[model samples]
Target: MDSNLLRVPDGSESVTDADEEIFLVYTALNQKPTDQIGPDGFRGLGHVDSRKDIISIRFELTALSHPTSSLSKVAEDNLASKSRKGKSARRTCNHADAPQTIEIELAQDKTALRSRKGDTGSVLWRASIAFAQVILQQHQFPQSNPLFDKDLLRKSHILELGAGTGLLSIALSALAKSYTATDIAPLLPLIRKNVALNFTGWTYNTRLQEGSPGSNICVEELDWETLLSLPPARRSHYYPKPAEPNAEWDLVLIVDCIYHPSLLPALVETIETVCTAAKTWVLVIVELRQEDVVREFLERWLSKGTWQLFRVEGLLELPYVIWAGQKGVP
Candidate 1:
């Protein structure tokens, strides 16, 4: 790791100081790196069986695993407080401290789940698992992590783009007030199925039907190419509506979504459209499977002057790099 990659702009800077924003870049390692690299790396990679028709994964939140870490006493107390407050106090079980477990059922071998023309997104990707762990670490240790803002998950509206299996959204849905997982039309059912596997109450569209309680997660279609064609006035029709008419999404999650170079522009455009407001943050996590695709994605993001990029540290090891891009100053 290069020492320069750790650099980031001061968070206290005013919105007017846009010129002072700096970009921290990290080149993915050509060789495969295992979870042995650090506690933050992907842990269950060795045990994953991609050949199965349906795969299930259980992850114990990293924030509660370490007794010596900052979350030790804090998590115990939080769990106790949640117990005292009763079921009404709990937002989602994922945020609770008692070894949060999210069981995601993935459709790896389904032909109907794939994108049109038979593309990826039907299977579970390794980066999404690493991403879930990283989110927990960042939320607990915001002072140390540059990319994540602890406040964003506190009753904030979160949207996930290209949410393949909706694993990441389901894993962290408890923390947000409302979470929308969007992908192509073909893969919407797969995401909805996976969401249903873990959560009790959820919807397939923006409108929340009555009787659906205990879950704030929803699955919808958000095609990047289609988003690019729509005008700014009509674009709002495609995006998932926040609870309030004036409310904007606080965070956008993009995990392992970048792969093909042809779709890079549409993806970047979609990011820009959603993150047009100030203080909106987008976390882009990509596996270093294709160098050209990753490079082009970064280049397009950087070309957009309003977006500032920061390289997230300690969340993932080589072959995986998560970039936190904010639309404007903190």
Candidate 2:
């Protein structure tokens, strides 16, 4: 019964005017009530008593997203201010050889932002940011690590799965010869928008792969479920085959994708399929939240025969691992 749930007790029936006021306060604060409905088949918003509490919640609503209300006007103003700042950021980036700035429009201001409950893919997860940091550190000191060997960046074709906000992919794009970010179809536009916003300097040559622009980075709709249902030969199609005659996906990057327990097996299968060639290497980073789900992924991944796992002992300040395929198996 978290506050976010906003559930009425099971015994409650019809919502009174007072009950409506409480529900109004809940929703007005940008909190969505659960699917539970009241006994009388109305919204399950039962009754509420404290007038002072309702007033306090009402005041808080101004900071949240509220359409058709005076509070929405404030939201608009804040976003306008952010836009001006965004322009300043772009100008500063152009002047200085600064790292590309990825503007994640949080639900508070951005039109593309969606509530986590509605679309978890739209939010910028910490794991994604941490993974990006790991890549930067490796790139800065490539000589120290064999995983990021001198030639890896120039020749590598990178693919990121469950790329929320496309942050990690965007960061890696500047390094890899080619990078692909994949998520569900609905999230493609938002991902593409983020790519275009950040990589303004990147060449827009879509003709890279045999008449294909071989764009440095691409955002494609790759439904994991669809891949899972495909025939065995076709399943490999989703997993990039070895491009350099010997290696499969010079490197595969995945972060924060193991939360859902049900999807663990599919995710594992996907990873195993992609790391088909012995030359392939996969770098996986999990945020370490949801201990149970993390445990499940680790157990499954540890037991999988496809990869010769290297437990990256504190390799990056962030959490991640490397999986090089079985030693010498063509």
- Candidate No. with top TM-score: 1
Predicted candidate 1: what Cα RMSD to the true structure? 8.8
lDDT of 1: 0.60
Tens-digit lDDT track for model 1 on 167-250? 777667766677888988878887876665444444454333532433677787889999888887887678776665787777
The numbered model that scores best in lDDT is: 1
**Count of backbone clashes for each model?**
0, 7
Off by over 4 Å in 1: 1-48, 62-100, 113-118, 137-152, 201-214
RMSD of 2: 17.0
lDDT of each: 0.60, 0.47
Clashing residue pairs found in predicted model 1: none
Each candidate structure's TM-score, on Cα atoms with residue i matched to residue i, is: 0.72, 0.60
**Alpha-carbon RMSD of each model:** 8.8, 17.0
Give the per-residue lDDT digits (tens) of candidate 2, residues 1-330: 011111112322322232342343334323323222211222311111111110100111111222111111111112323332212112113322233223322221133343334355665554454445444444543323324554546667777878866766655665666788888777777676565544443333333333222246777777777777788788876654433465456567777676678888778777767663455566666533344675566567655643454434333321222222231253
Could you tell me which 10 consecutive residues in candidate 1 have the lowest summed lDDT? Answer: 69-78
